[model samples]
Target: MPKPAIFWDPAGLELDSLGSNSYLRSTDGDTPYVSLSIRMLSVDTPETHYPGRSKPARSDEKLAELASWIQEGAAPIDDGLAAHLQPKLETGRAGTLHGEQGEAAHEHFERLVEEKLTKPSGRKRRVYLKSGNEPFDRYGRLLAYMAPNYTRAERDEMTPLESASFNLLMVASGWAASFIIFPSLPKHSDLCLFQEEGRKAVEDGLGAWSDPLTLTGYEFRMCVKLHTVTKELMQGKKLSKAERLRWIDRYCCDMSTRGVYSPQDYYRVPAYDRIFIWKKDVNEAVARLNLSPEV
Candidate 1:
């Protein structure tokens, strides 16, 4: 029997509409940059009130109810339920230490608290240095290895016609960025047609940003703007396939211009890095679905 089709959506991330957040607007003009926010949704939290019920139902039951509520558009969780569950969620068994590892973890936790307390009121503070020793590195490595493999599998799982259509979308998205960065490339003219095909794919996906005509216009201007900025870099007669790919990587991943400047003037902030990294992951996931083989 054929395996079930999988649909993926990255949770807890939101794409803010233009003008919703004042800080996200471009400094010189009204153009908007995407602002991503992460939200915590606790599954252990209950939603209803049933006075004197047997221990307020099991944890698994509450989780199931939460899923149902979300599917039904997330009805407001009452204070009574939140009050009962919050303590349970917060309370966890203390770690049993056998060696220096326990002491180190405790020390790190205390240092984090001290740093948080030292920050000035109304001022932005840095958190989580980019050192590879952080707790999340193991998970990151696993994901990095798995994603490309998953993409390859996903691609092979599709029918021949589906593979052709999906690959066309990937090429189109690539070309959209390409036209902006290196219009002098041999296949530059093909971008316009590829872009139209991309629009159709976006519409079919029913994505939040799916507006074919508007996206096409935006992409055209984006290509022109990118060309203007990187013209000098692309000066030598023609850029190779690898060089063009590098330019696309830089163009889509460039958050330098969107540097944070607020209560603190820190140019490179931890939050900025985290958000950008998460955005890159989501973008790659989208690309994998389009171009990689299924798992």
Candidate 2:
């Protein structure tokens, strides 16, 4: 059962009410509650933190530039973004735009919260959560999609678009891009709706999409991973392919080409077409989503 808890951020990443008022669980003694970290499903906002406060992306500086790393034999994330970020690095602005756009995305999401999840009385509205098949992400954040909790009357009065999940609303609002992953994939109809909203968001250049050079939150994480990997390689650490892939998450399906692509190819796949999958799940996803294997 869901509990009333304070959301710490617009992305629904974590909750601040760590004790009595918390998400997911209550201890047998009832004095404390387990803190739940949630990685919201179906959408990803821009890269928000540098010198980050958490793990996975524990900041080692946003190594958005690919030239030196590429010169060191590291693969380029994507040609255009590589060039786009290169100057920023050369001119000492490498991580600035990433952080700026992240703030922009967060502020945009707050506006979305007010518009989509606020009540007429100015209280925060209720929401329903739909989780993915796998409940916990690698970072231990619970994965979910928060939908507006509406009465039948309210549902009847609103259009499907208006009655969207907060996940969808984020995409529609233009701050978040469509971020579907395998096995956790929504129903086909919902996926189509996500694509439509994403199309509009991109076309309108809303939020992160407005900044042509902005990396999707996922891509930012990947670049950081690559940098980390390159760092280890630079130190001559002996790492297996699997061990190397463990932290650098970029595996996915390319919808346009109907093929699976590894993390390095992630930037080539557009947000709407990219279906992120953990490295281990790529085989299962191929069978489940019916896409071709990596070429």
Candidate 3:
């Protein structure tokens, strides 16, 4: 629990959201400075907007299929929460809001920020970026635990195991999923804190946790990738209902240890296990080709 050195540039970065987790940040708040897309680290919220206008992510039919799989698998949702989640689950099913709970998480975070801005006391704020062991993600976004206007000095009195991470706050508040990209980063405190918070949220049936589905960002990515890879193998052939599940079983077993990327790939979760939590949509897509369940 030794303190990692804080990475901070003296000049403030002007941070504004392009969407839920992505931000457009500049070196200076007023005068122009080098700007880049800052995606919050270790936090993945349900996306509320489309990727068409921003830095492009891999968006295609396969991704759409992945989204639908996540939602469809979460069917027969709680009646009390279904109303708010329907829009997020069904909106632009081809691209945005693919999860069962939809954009509720996105809206929740936005509303929280907006409320902070309109506070009558006019609280002063600063963005604190705590660089993790790995500073850049595959997408070229800086991987740092970001806190808007909160600082280390505020938490100096706390013990080594304590965390004041806004990123952790998101999970603690049930607004984001705990996305651990690098497990060996000596980030035990924050990692443990987020896991505890995430578990509690799930136990309380909050946000994405409400569906009783919990996955790291890397796990989610692997689920989508696994589906795409399986589809490619089938090459549009329709499989019988029984064959569909069997195919998934075979694919997962074969790819369990096969490296999806390279030596540094962080998706350690096996495909076979992820199948139970991540395969509904892919199953339906294959089922559609056959038309008849028995076929």
Clashes of each: 11, 1, 4
Q: Top TM-score: which candidate number? A: 2
lDDT digits (tens) for residues 1-295 of candidate 1: 9876997776532234223544555655666545433111100011111222322222223333433442343323234433332232222210111112223323443453344334345453332211111212221211010001123565588643233321232323322111111111112233333344444544453321232211222222222233332343334446554443231222121122323222111112221121112223444533532322211
lDDT of 3 at 204: 84
> Stretches of candidate 1 above 4 Å error?
1-212, 216-226, 229-240, 250-291
> Which stretches of candidate 3 lie above 4 Å from their native place?
1-32, 49-102, 115-120, 151-163, 183-186, 213-220, 236-295
Candidate 2's error at 59, in angstroms? Answer: 6.7
Best by lDDT: 2
| Superior by TM-score: candidate 2 or candidate 3 | 2
lDDT of each: 0.28, 0.69, 0.45
lDDT of 2 by residue, 1-295 (tens): 9886876656442333343344665567765555555688988877766436543233424463344775454642456555544543433344566667777778877777677777777877777888889776766566898887888998999988889888888888788878888778877777878888888888888877776656667656656666777677767888887666655564778766778876666656667777788777877877876888665
- In candidate 3, list every pair of residues with a backbone clash: 69-281, 88-102, 126-149, 127-149
Sorting all predicted structures by TM-score, with the top scorer first, yields 2, 3, 1
lDDT of 2 at 168: 85
